[model samples]
Target: MDDTPVRVLIVDDQTLMRQGLRKLLEIEPGVTVSGAAASGQEALALLATTTVDVALVDAKMPGMDGVALIRRLAAEHPSVACVILTTFDDDEYIFGGLAAGARGFLLKDTPPDELVTTLRRAAAGETVLGSPAAERVVARLRTDPHGTGLEALSAREREVGDLIAQGAHNREIARRLFITEGTVKNHVTALLRKLGMRDRTQLALFLAKHRDQR
Candidate 1:
C-alpha cells in the first residue's frame, strides 16, 4: 500500500466544524488537510488551484448545498473523490449526497478514525458509507430489492452492474471485462438509465439486493 497521505479539502459553512475537522485530520498520520472552505464557491476556487485527493463536504451549507457541490465536483474535478460529512441523517440528504456523486456519506458523529478511513477509501476509488448511512441504505434495499427495469439490461450491462456491486470502478471493470474504460462507462450509463438510478452507488446496491435474481 502507498504510504502517501491523502490530501483532504474541508468544505463546511460552520467555522467551528471546518476548524475542528482540519485539526482532527491533521493529527492523523495518513491524512492531510489540504484546505478548508466556508462554502461551495470557496471550495470550487480552492479546488481549482489546490491538489486535493478527497473533499469532505457538509451536506447543508448555506449557498450551494453538499449535493450540489458534489455534482459540480463530479463534473469539474472528476479525480477528486467527494465525501459528505454532515449532522443531518435524513433520507433526503443521505440519498441526495449519494446520487450527486459522493463516494461516502458519513454523519458528523462518526469517529475520528472512521472518518480518516473513509477519506482514504474514497480517495482509493471505493464508495463507502458510514455505519448509520449504511443501515439506511440496507433498509431501502430490503424494501426495493428489485429496481424498475433490470430485465431490460443487456448481458454485458448485467456484467458491468455485477462488477460495480463488487466494488470495481470503471478502470477495473474495463480490465476485468476486456474492454476499454470508455466502453465500461457507456455500459454504466446505460445501466443507470435502464434501472432508473442516479449514480453507481445506487446501481451497485440495486444489483447486490437482487443478485439472486440475476
Candidate 2:
C-alpha cells in the first residue's frame, strides 16, 4: 500500500479461476494480486476497504453479472480500471461491458503473457477492447444504413474522428490537440464505445462518410 508494487483485485465466481489468476499474475514484476473475490458483492466490499489499481472481473457471475459489476465499480470505485475476462465474445456483451466503463475486455483463453500486459495497460489507465468477434461488430457498424449511433458523438469526439478519418495515429492526434498521448488514447476508447464502432479503423471510416455533416 506504501511505495509498493501495483495492487490488483481479482473477481470471478469460480474459486479455481481466482487461484489461477493469482498464480499467473504473481510472476509479473512490480504487480501484486492484493485480493481475490468470488462475486461482485464481495468485490465491492473488498474495494471499500482496500486500494487496488486494476481489477480482473469475470464477465459472468451469479446475482451480479460483469456488466452490472462494472457499472457499480465505475460509480463507486471510479479509479479502478476493470479488465473483463469472459468466455463469450457476443457483441451485446462487448457494447454492454464498455458502456459499464470497463477499460479492457479480454477473453479467458488469452495467453498469460498477454494478460499481464493488458493488466499493465489498464493500470496505466488506457482503454483497450477488441476480439475476433468484435471485428464483425465493427464491420457492421461501418456498413450500417443510417449510422445513427455515430451521429451522436460529442464535438471533441467528432474532431478526433475527423483526424482518425485522415489517418492520423494516436500520437499525431495528441500532438495536434496538445494533450498527452494517454489522453488521446482514452478519448479514442470513449469514442469507440459511444459510437458502437469496434476500433480506430471503423471510427476513421465513420468520419469519412460523415465529414460533411460535421
Candidate 3:
C-alpha cells in the first residue's frame, strides 16, 4: 500500500458542511483536503484539474446530486474513489450512490475517527459502509431474495458472488479462493453481465439476497 497521504475533495452544497469536513479530514495524519466544492458541477470543474484519491460527496444537492455525481465520476474520473455523506440514511441514496460506483456510504454524524478511517480504507480500494447503511443493505437483501438472478451463475461464479456479498474486493477474493485477481475480475464481469447489474454494489446485493439458498 502507498504510504503517501490520501488526497480528498469535499462536495456539499452547504458551505459549513464542506468546511467542517475539510477541517476534520485535514487534521488526520494520512489525509489531505485537496479542494472543496459546493455542488457537483464545481466538483467536476475541480476534478478536471486536480487529482484526488477520494471524493467525499453529499447525497443531496440542488443539481447533479451525489448519486449522479458518482456516476459521472465513474465515467470521467475513474481513478478517484467516491464516498457518499448524508444526514439521512435513505435507502434510495445509499443504493443509488453505491450502484453509481461510490466506494463508501457514511452519515454526517459518523465519528471523526471512523470517518477518517473509512476514507483511508476507500482510498486503499476497500468498500466502507456506516453501520446503519450496512444494516439497510442487509435488510434490502432479506426483503427480496428471489430475484437475485443467482440461478444463472455457475458454481465458481456463485463462490465469487458469495465473497462479493460479504464485501470482499477482487484482490481479497482472489487470495481467499486461491485464484488470480484477473480471474476474480473475470468472474465479476460474468456475474455483472449475467445478472444485468451495473457494478459490484448490485452484485453484492444480489448475492446477499440469495445467500440462504447457497
Candidate 4:
C-alpha cells in the first residue's frame, strides 16, 4: 500500500455534501481532503493550484458536468484520478463518467467507510465502482457483447484485461502476475489499443460480458 496519505478534492454543487465528505475523509487515517469545489470550473481552478490524488466529483453540476471535468482532467492532469459521487445511478451518467477517464463511480449515499476506501483505491490507481454502478456496467455489457472485439487481444493482453475487469490496479496486477508495474502498464496500453477501447472502464465492461467464457 502507498505510505503517503491520499489527497482528495471534493467537487459537488451542494455545500452540505462537500462539507460532509470533507469531514468524513479528514477523519480517515490514510486520506485527507485537500479542497472542495462547488462546480466543475471551480474544481478545475483548484486543480490548477493544488495537486490532489483523487477528485470526488458529482455527476450533475450547473456548468461543466462531472463527465466533462473528468475528460478535461484526463487530458490536462493525467495523474489525478477522478471518481464520480452522485445521487443518480443512470446508465448514461455512469458510462459517460467512465468513458471520460473516471477511475471510480460511487453514489452520494455510500457509507462513509466505503467512500473513504473507494477514494483510497482510486488514489492507488484502481478502477473502483459502487455496487449499483458495477451492476449497471455488467448489464450494459450483457446487452452489447458482440461489438467489443475481445478476440483481438493477445493471450498476455487477455490476462491483463481480466485483472483490469476485476478492478485490479497496475501495482496489484503486477504483483499478482509477477511482473513490473511498467510492464503491466505496457500491456494495458497495448490491449486498450488492440481493443480500441477508450479506457479501463470500457475494457472491464467488455470483459464482464464475456467473463463466463473466460
Candidate 5:
C-alpha cells in the first residue's frame, strides 16, 4: 500500500508449502512475508497480533478450511484481504471462496511472476481471481434464467458497469465520468447489489462477456 513492501501472511497446513510460498513472494518486488501459519486457528490468532495486509489461504486443511477462514477473517479483520490458494479445480471451491469474501483465488501452481502480480493487484483493491477459472466461474453465472440480469441497473449504474468491463478502477472511473470517488463507490456497490454479483471483478466479467450485443 506504500513505498514499503506489502505485508503478506501465508496460511496453509503444510510447512513446506508455506516456506515455498514465502520464498516465492520474497522474490517479488515490494512484497514481504510477514508471517506464516499451518492452520486457520493459528492464522486467525496471528492476525490478532500482527499487521497483515493480505492473506494467502489454503483451500484444504484440517480444522477450518480456506473458505470458512475467508468468511471468518473477513468478519473479524476487515482490514485484511483474503485470497484463496489451492490446487482445487472444483466449482464448489471457486464459488464458495468468492461467496465467502475471498478477493482472489490462485491455483497452487501459479507461476511466481503471476502470483506476485495477483498479490499486487489484490493489494490495489482489485479482485485477481486466477484466469481461466475466474472466467469459467463468471460464465456459469451468465446462464441465469433471467438473462444477464445486469439490466436491473439504473442508467448510471450501467455506465459504472460498462467502464468496469473496460478495466477502469473506481478512481479512474470517477475521473472519467467527472464524479467523486465516493459516488463511484456507491454506484459500484449499488450495481453489484442489483445484479446479484459478489464483487467488481464479476461485474467486469459480465460486461465483457456481453459486449458483443452492444
Candidate 6:
C-alpha cells in the first residue's frame, strides 16, 4: 500500500466493458489503468511495450481467448500478474483460468472496493479467488483430503492427470506427451475410473487440490 499506484491493463471484447473498467479503476486511490485492449492478441502486444503490474482479462474473447492469453503472460511476462475478471463462473473457466496462472479470478459483479483490493493484492503476488470460485476450490480440497485413490495411477496416467489438472485438452495432452489423442482419451478414462470421479472437472479439481498441498 505505498503511494505508487498499481498499474493495470484491461482486456475485454466489449468496448463499454473496457471503458467502464478503465473509468472505474482510474478513480481508485492505489490503482491506475495503464491501457485497455479489445482482444488477447492486442493485450499481449500492449504488454510487450508497456509496463503493467496486472492485466485484468475477460474469460471469453473472440480470438486467442483469456486462458490462452494468461498462459502466454505467465510464460513471457512472469512479472506481470494476470487476473480473470469475467462474468462467467463456470468450472471450466474457473479452473482453466487458475491453471493458466491467473493470480486472481473475479466476477464482474464484485464490488468496486473489493475488486480494487483484489487487483492490488494480485499485483503484490497473492492468489485471490472471489466468492463461488473460492468456495468451489475449498469444496474440492475437502472432498479428498488425502487423495486416497492416487496411489493406483501408473506413471503415464499420473502425467496425463497432472496435465489435465493444468487444463490441457486431450489434443494438447497428446501433443505434449508424444501420444495419440485416442491414447490420451484412454488415459483420461482410466483416470476417471481409478479416481472414481464423474468427469474431467472433478479429475482436474482433485489433482489441483493435491498439487496445491504439495
Worst 10 residues of 5 by lDDT: 144-153
Q: lDDT tens digits, residues 94-170, model 1?
A: 76677677899998999988889899999999999988889877876776564244555689988998889898999
Error of 3 at 102 (Å): 0.9
Candidate models: Cα lDDT each: 0.86, 0.80, 0.85, 0.83, 0.80, 0.85
TM-score, per-candidate, Cα-based = 0.68, 0.65, 0.68, 0.68, 0.66, 0.70
Q: 65-140, model 4: which lDDT tens digit per residue?
A: 7787888899899999999999998765677678678999998889988988898889889999999989877876
Name the runs in model 2 displaced over 4 angstroms: 1-4, 133-137, 144-214
- What TM-score does candidate 4 reach? 0.68
Give the runs in model 4 whose Cα sits over 4 Å from its true position. 146-214
Candidate 3 local lDDT, 21-131, one digit each (tens): 888887889898999999999999999899899999998898677887888899999989999999978666776677678999999989999999999999989999999
Model 2 score (lDDT)? 0.80
What stretches of model 6 exceed 4 Å from their correct place? Answer: 144-214
Residue 25's lDDT in candidate 2: 88
User: 2 or 6, which is superior by TM-score?
Assistant: 6
C-alpha RMSD in Å of predicted model 6 compared with the true structure: 8.2
Report how far off residue 108 is in candidate 1 (Å).
Answer: 0.9
Q: Of the pair 2 and 5, which is ahead by TM-score?
A: 5
Model 1, residue 163: distance off in Å is: 36
Count the clashes in each prediction. Answer: 0, 0, 0, 0, 0, 0
Error of 2 at 140 (Å): 4.7
TM-score of 1: 0.68
Q: How accurate is candidate 1 locally (lDDT)?
A: 0.86
User: TM-score: which candidate is best?
Assistant: 6
